[model samples]
Target: MKIGKIPPDVLERLVFNRRGAPRREVLVGPAIGEDAAIIDLGGYYLAIHTDPISGSIKLLGYLAVYVPTNDIAVRGIPPMWLSIALLFPPETDETLLDEVTKQIDLAAREVNVAIVGGHTEVTSAVGRPVAIATAIGVGRRYISTSGAKPGDVVFMTKSAGQETASILATDFENEALKKGINKEVLDRAKELAKAVSVLREALALADLATSMHDPTEGGIANGLAEIAYASGVSIEVDPSKVIVYREVEELCSAFGIDPLETLSSGVLLATLPPDSVQEAEERLKKLGIPYSQIGRVTPVATSL
Candidate 1:
């Protein structure tokens, strides 16, 4: 009944339970923490995911492409094709449509994905424009958020609430300025929008990751909670190790939002073996992506 993602218990009861009979072709089906559905396609696995952008209208098109694509990427697959569905209100103007479609085109090209097919329509079924994208890709190996094991180190890419900062800065600039945030700080926060894509770092670290999660609606806190619940493990995170960009801090402070619990599409949370930490850091540094060792996974205690 919330505006964001459904609660786990409710999802399990209403959605996950009615996912139909298990099929041999479905290598990975619907689950709490799994990013995309993995289907066995003879020689390789097909990773597919769909996401809708209804929260922020300013970046709808861009978010439509990258959000779902990030899901497929976290599965260690390069998204190759996308299908977008654009639904607009009856009063929507032609210029808005053109702008959104253009953004969709530019974003798809930026990620090297083709717009294979999609549907667009203006109807009274919605208040504002909504864009949903489904991304598909093929890969030999896939990683799931449930794969994190005991003794694995938890890693986070970029900073906390990067997406949140960008969204607030872009869509709520006036409110931020009214709250005493300077124009320069707001502009810098807006720049964070371009860094929302985590495909590069996800692919680069996929090989070393036991599990990967794209923190979205609930930021790092929810992402970590999902991984822990899915993997049946306990994760201890050091707050000091989690990096929060200065702009993000200011924006969150202005809005009274907890950065750790805000939207964080750009951040990639992963778990890796202790031995792979050095290699992962090296690869990230070479790619110029900042990261941090935030925590470690441990087995949950059980009564004997």
Candidate 2:
């Protein structure tokens, strides 16, 4: 209903209830924690995720590619191809288009993903440029965001407010500076955007992860809640274990935004078996990825 993703309850009641007939090939359809739609394709499964870049304009193309790509990666598969769409306001100029396209191309190349096809139009109906992408991948074995068990441990990779801090700093540098956030800190915040993709951490812990989720629109809290909802369990998260940046805190405080509830794209939430935690931690450590065991899944509460 707001600027970010639709709340889970509303989506379940209105959208999820209206999804068409069920099919045998549809392994994973629309759900709360499930990131991508998985379709059985004989020997392997096809994972697809789609998202739009609507909140920020600084890195339009980069965000468009990475947002959905992060979803696909959490499925324990490398994104192979993407279908992108670009919608620009009628007043948009050729130079803006060039920069967006260039960014898209470079970001796709960096991830070794191909831009298959999409649509582009300059429409007056939109007020700004919006880029959307659908990422597709195939894998033999994959983890769903709904697979967490009751006793599984929950971990969050990287920090909170990663995308939020970066977007605010980059899009509102002057405003942030005026808010008493140091220039150097703002510059560092801008660099956090590059860490938005959790492909490496996702892949490293894929085998050990029973469930994995990308904290995008609703930050770490909502992401964990989605996992708990999807798995039919409750998560006991320790807020003290969450990594929060000072810059993010200050900027969010200045704007009256709750850092924990803000958008955080780079962070990954994972649920793993108790026995597999060691291996998962080892792999992440070897890869130089930071993670924290912030919570544990509990049995779902029921009415007496």
Candidate 3:
């Protein structure tokens, strides 16, 4: 198993295929690109998503809250509540616990989400602290990652690999400096962490987007691939149009990781009707959110 997301084939055979009986209320279940599980509650829909923060130790608490909530946001709903499970090793100190809790508290408040309930434990089952968060929200209308259709235009908010750069800068600062990455560049990259939340942008574009996805573990390329696979569409992306921040590129270059394939939680990928592109662009600009028109969705190729 890789360090990041499970391989698609493995997931289908071991996870997706084994899902229990279906229900009418489950509007959206597990799928390649779907961000959250949506359940119909009479007139409204409930969106729920869970994510674990295990990649970067320094940002575990912050990432745990934002990552899962980002999933709900991409579904066009504000995450109203969160349940976080904190797992720490037996030797962990009280100060570490306080720090992580404070981080979670601040992050949840920033997104206006309430931490209703959760569990905390110290055991030998884990070597490092891990924070898992599940976010829930309600909305009348929601978007799915599989809603993209042919002729729709693909758009991306923020830049690629922003989270990855921040992680490397914060968690692997010494390594980055040894690779000749300057302190100033690394500092700039660290600041990119604040941009990880796409809640505002996702909500702003919710009405306009046919589909939306929070590109996390796989960066923009993998995110696009998931959208194409889930929607049964083909996406033609212009590499030149994909925005990669200069600091992100520098850190990624030093680390020898593809910016397009690294974990990118800050970026939001969306598809919209060609006619709605103008409105979407205008909305993003008005909100002062940077974005790019990266490609178009097309029909999947078929043999003659």
Number of colliding residue pairs in each model = 0, 0, 0
lDDT of 2 by residue, 1-304 (tens): 5766787789989999998888999988998878999999998989998898878877888888888999999999999999998999989999989988887898888788899999999998789899889999999978898898989999998878889888899888899888888888888888888888889899888889899999888898889888988888899999999988787787788778888888889899999999999999899899998899998999998899
How does each model score on TM-score?
A: 0.97, 0.96, 0.97
Number of the top lDDT candidate: 3
Ranked by lDDT, the better of candidates 1 and 2 is 1
lDDT of 3 at 213: 97
**After superposition, candidate 2 runs with Cα above 4 Å error:** 1-3
Order the candidate numbers by lDDT, best to worst: 3, 1, 2
Which pairs clash in model 1?
none
Candidate 2 Cα deviation (angstroms), residue 223: 0.2
Q: What is the C-alpha lDDT of each candidate?
A: 0.92, 0.89, 0.93
Return the clash pairs for model 3, or none: none
Off by over 4 Å in 3: none
Question: Once all C-alphas are superposed, what RMSD does model 3 give against the true structure?
Answer: 1.1
